[model samples]
Target: MQKDIYVVGMMVDERGSKAPDVQQVITRYGDKILCRNGIPSPSRERGIITLTMEATPEDYQRMEQDLKGLKGVTVESIHFSQPESFQLCENR
Candidate 1:
């Protein structure tokens, strides 16, 4: 199976009740997550979270399903592929 590096964004529309559920799912898949950042909206009714993750396609879809099962939560992710080469001196 091919592995992927991803940046995921999660939105919580009803933070009061939904945030806890979101946290639970996030914790369950914490091993696949490399980094996490969360911010609350100005009104405090909603929240936004960003995650950096590395996993196989199967694992990614499973995690996505878990998060999407919660009400008022939406998940989006972008996959990043490895570069063939890096030239450090080219930018100069």
Candidate 2:
């Protein structure tokens, strides 16, 4: 399994959909998605909402593909964690 962590920033049209759609997104993504949230941003259009989801590298690509197909939602940015090699440390 890949250890890389991916954080995706998303923007969705908050109109025309019921509140349950948000929950559906989370349910669809399921276990591969570690964290998901929809945050309202007043600085922009009232209907524009910010969403964030975190996943492993493999899961990120799959999740992105799925989300991209959904209407009215746009992926703003995908942040990837740097790869690092490490030896076992004495401290746990």
lDDT agreement with native, every candidate: 0.84, 0.56
Candidate 1 local lDDT, 1-92, one digit each (tens)? 45678899998998878887898988988998889999976678889999998777788889899999888998999998644363213554
lDDT value, candidate 1, whole model: 0.84
Q: Per-candidate RMSD vs. true structure?
A: 4.7, 4.6
In model 2, how large is the Cα lDDT of residue 54? 45
Best by lDDT: 1
Stretches > 4 Å off in candidate 2: 16-19, 41-54, 82-92
Q: Please report the TM-score between candidate 1 and the true structure.
A: 0.81
